[model samples]
Target: MNSKSELIKFEEGISLESGDNLSSFELMIETYGDLNDSKTNAVLVCHAFSGNHHVAGKKSNGEIGWWDEIVGPNKAIDTNKYFVVCCNNLGGCSGSSGPSSINPTTGKIYGKDFPIVSVKDWVNSQNMLTERLGIPRWLFVVGGSLGGMQALEWSIAYPEKILKAGIFAAAAKSSTQNIAMNEVGRESIRKDPNFNNGDYIELGVKPKNGLKTARMLGHITYLSEENMDLRFGRKFQDSNSKVDGKVDFEVENYLQYKGEKFTENFDANSYILMTKAMDGYDASKNFKNLDEALSSVSSELLIVGFDSDWLYPPERGKEIQLAAMNNNIRSSYITLDGRQGHDSFLFASEKYEEIIQDFVGS
Candidate 1:
C-alpha cells in the first residue's frame, strides 16, 4: 500500500482531436506497487467524471482516494501483483493541465479557451504517458462510467497496446436521454450569474452556487429511485422545518450535501468539458456499425452493468458484448444485481469484487 503521486510534462506538445496543439501540458498520476523489470505487469485505471488520479491510498491531507476500496493490496485490482497507474485527464482540475492551468501565451488560465477534448484525445495523452513511463503495453485498461468509455476506446484505438479491458456501467455511445441530462446540468451552471461564462476564475470568483446545483443534478442520475427510497424515503430532514418548505426531505438534504462537497474540489469549467466529452463519445462513430467498429478490438474484454442502472442500462452492456462476439473477440458480459444504479461499480460489494478479481486474474 505504498502509493505515490507525480506530475509528468509532455514538452513536445499534444495535438488534440479539435485540431489544436497544446504547447505543453502535464498529467498528475498516482502509482502503486513496483513496475517489473519487464514492464509488462502494468494496469492502467481510468477515472470517471469528477474523479482524478488519486485512485487509491491516502493523499498528503490523509484523505482517501475515490477508489481506495477496490484498488489496494489484496483488493480486486491487487496492487501487490500489478503496477497500477491512474492519471488525472488533461482537462481535469485535479493537479492536471486544464481550464484552471496557466496558458503559456496569455499567462492566464485557459478557462473558456480550453480546447474541446474527446475520449480519443484522452487515450492519445495516456499513450504518451505510457511511453514516458517505459511501459510496453498495459496488461489491462479498466474503468467505469465515463472512464469505461475511455477503456472501450483504448481497445479500438490501440488494439496492439492492450491485452485486456474491463468496462463497467457504460455504453458504446451516449443515448439521447444521456445527452439531455448533461445539457440540463450544463445549463444550470451557465445560467448562474456567477459562472461568468466560464471565466469565473479570472473574475476572482467561483460559481459555487451554479456548480453545486449542477452537481446535485448529476448526483440524482448516479443513484436509482429504489436506492433513494431505501436510503431516505420520504423522511424529513428536520420535522420542525417542514412548515417552511426549506430542505424538508431527507433526500434533498443528502443531495444538497453532496453538491456542496463537490463544488469544494471540482472546477466548474472542467465539469462542462468532461460532460461534453461524454456527449461526444461514440465508439462506433467511424465505422458503418458497432460490430464493424468492434472488429478491430483485439483485447480480451469484460463488460459489467448494474440491473438498476437506467442511465446506462444493462442492455447497453449487452450491446457491446454482442458486437464483440460478432467480431470474434473474447468477451464476457455480466449484469450485477443491485439497486445502486450507475454508482454500483464504485461500491465494495463482495460479488462485484469477485467479478473483477476473476476477470483480471484470468
Candidate 2:
C-alpha cells in the first residue's frame, strides 16, 4: 500500500480534560484503504510512545511504515478490507501540536509551557478528528503498549463509537516500577547540559547525550533478558586491539546505534512529556473501580500478553480481563509465548498475526 500523510487543522481547538484549551491545532494522519459508503468499516489504530501516524505501507520517500508487516493488503489488520486511520497523538512531536510546536499566544515554542495532556485528552482529540472525517463508528479500535491503553480508554469512554477493542501488552495503569523507569528517563533529559530548561532549540543545541541515554535505557526494557542473551550473548564487537577499559560488547554497540538514531529524530521535551503522560494514565480513576470502569464498555475486547514481557506482564493483561468478566463484557485474553518482551506486540509472527486476523475477521 502506498500512503500519504495529511495534516488537518482544527480551528475549533479542543478543551482538554485538564481544563486547558488550545485555540487551534493540527493533526498529522495517514489513512489506508477506503471507507465504505456507510463509513462503518473504519478501524482506528492508536500509536504508542515515539510512534507517529505512519502505521503501515510505504511513503513517497521509500520509507516503510512502522507496522507495515501487519497492516498492508491481506495482512493482519488488512487495510484492503478495512479503512485504517492513524494519527500522531496531540502531544507528539511528529507534526502534531506539542512542546515543539509554536504557541500562537506567545509567538514562541510551547516547550515547557505546553499543557500537560493526558490519555483522555488524546482520545478526545482523536474523537474530533474522527468526527471531522465523517466516521460514524469504528469497526475496531486497537493498539499495543501505550497505544493499547488508549484503545482500552476508547472502549470505556466512547463505548457506543467502537465495536471491538484490541489491547496488547498494556496495563490499565503504570506500575510503580514502570513509573520509576519513566522518571529516570525524564531525569536524564532534564540533567543534560544542553537541555537548558527545555529550551535547547532556542539555545541552538540539542540534548543529544541525554536523549541518547534515555533511549538506551528504554530499549533495554523493551527486550527480554532471554532474547538479549540469544541475540548478542556477551559477544565482542571485534577482535581488534583491546583498549584499556573499553566496552566492546556487541549488545552495547547495538544500543549505542539505536540511541544515536533516536536522538536525531525525536525531541527531548516531547520525550519527557510523553513518558509523564504514560506514567500519569490510570484508566479506572474516573470510575469506582476497574470493574465499574469497564461496566459501560459495549465493545468486545481482546487482550493479549507476552510471556516474557516483564514490563506490563501477563498478569496485568489478565487483570483487565478479570475486570471485564466481572461486568460480563464479552472479552478474551491470550498470552503469547514469546521472548521479545514488551515489544512482542510490535513484531509480526505466525501466531500473533493469526490471532489478530481471526479477531478482526470475526
Candidate 3:
C-alpha cells in the first residue's frame, strides 16, 4: 500500500473537555491508499497506548508499521479499496503536541503543565483533522484496546460522521483493577530520580528506569498465562549456569529486553498522561448506564473480545454489545478463543480476518 505521514498544524487549536484551550496544536497523521472521488470510502484507524500514526506499510526509515499485518493491499482492512487514516493522538509524544511539545504561550515544553486530555478531547481534535481532509464522514472507524475506546467515542460524539465502529479488546469503562495498574505505572515514573518531577527533558535526562519498570509491568498484563508458559515455560536463560539470583529465567530476560527497548522510543511523561486518560474514560459516566450512553449512537458496532483476555475479557465486550442492542442499534459480539490475552486482536488476526472483512464489506 502507498502510505505517507504528514504533520498538519491547526492555528485555531482546540478547547479541551476540561475547559482549557490550546492556542495552536499539530497532529501527526499517516494515510494509506487513495481517497475515492466521493470521499465516502475513508476509514479511520485509531491507535492504542504507546502507538503512533504509523499504522501500516513501511516508513521512510525502513521500519514496518504496527498494524501492517492487518492493513495492506487486499488485507483485512483492504487498503486497495479504502483509504485508511491513523493519527498520533493530540497529547501523544510521537510528533503531536503533548508534554514534549513546546507550549505556544510559554515558549517552553508543556511538561506537567500540559492540560489533561480525555478520550472525548481526542475525538474533538480528530474531527478537526477529518474536516481538514474534507472527509464529510468515515465509512468506518476501527481500533483495538485504547484505540477501540476512541472508536467508541467517535460514534458517540459525532454519530453523523461514522457509519460503523470496530471495538476490539476494549471496554466501555476502565475496570477498577485496570485503574490500579495504571496508577502503579504512573507512580513508577514519578518515583524515578531522573524523572525530576516531569521536567527531565530540560535536565537532559530521562526516566528510563521508571519507564522501563512500568513497561515491564504492563507487558505482563498483555499476555496470557498460557502464552507465557508456551513461550518461556520456566526455561533458564542459560542452561550452563546455575541460579545465582541474577535473572535465571528466560522470561526475566525477555521482559527486561522489552522494557529496555520501550524506554528508548517512548516518553515517560507521555506514558503517564496516556494511561491517566485511559483510566478516566467511562462512557456510561454521563448517562444512567451503558445502554443510555449508547442510546444516541447511530453507528453499528462490531465488538470482539478475547476469551483469555483478563485485562478486558469477553464479558466486557458483551456488555457493550448488549447495551447497543438495548438501544435498538445493530451490534455483533465475538468471543475469540486465544492464548495471546489482550493482544490477541493483533497476534491472532488471521483467526478473525474474514469476520472483519465481511463486517466492513456489509
**Cα lDDT of model 2 by residue, 91-112, tens digit:** 7888989989898879998888
Candidate 1, residue 295: the lDDT equals: 82
RMSD of 3: 1.9
Number of colliding residue pairs in model 1: 0
The alpha-carbon lDDT assigned to residue 226 of candidate 3 equals 95
Q: Report lDDT (CA) for all predictions.
A: 0.92, 0.90, 0.91
Could you estimate the TM-score for every candidate? 0.97, 0.97, 0.97
Lowest-sum lDDT 10-residue window in model 1: 239-248
Ranking by lDDT: 1, 3, 2
lDDT of 1 at 316: 95
Model 3 TM-score, 2 decimals: 0.97
lDDT of 1 by residue, 203-239 (tens): 8899888888889999999899999999999987886
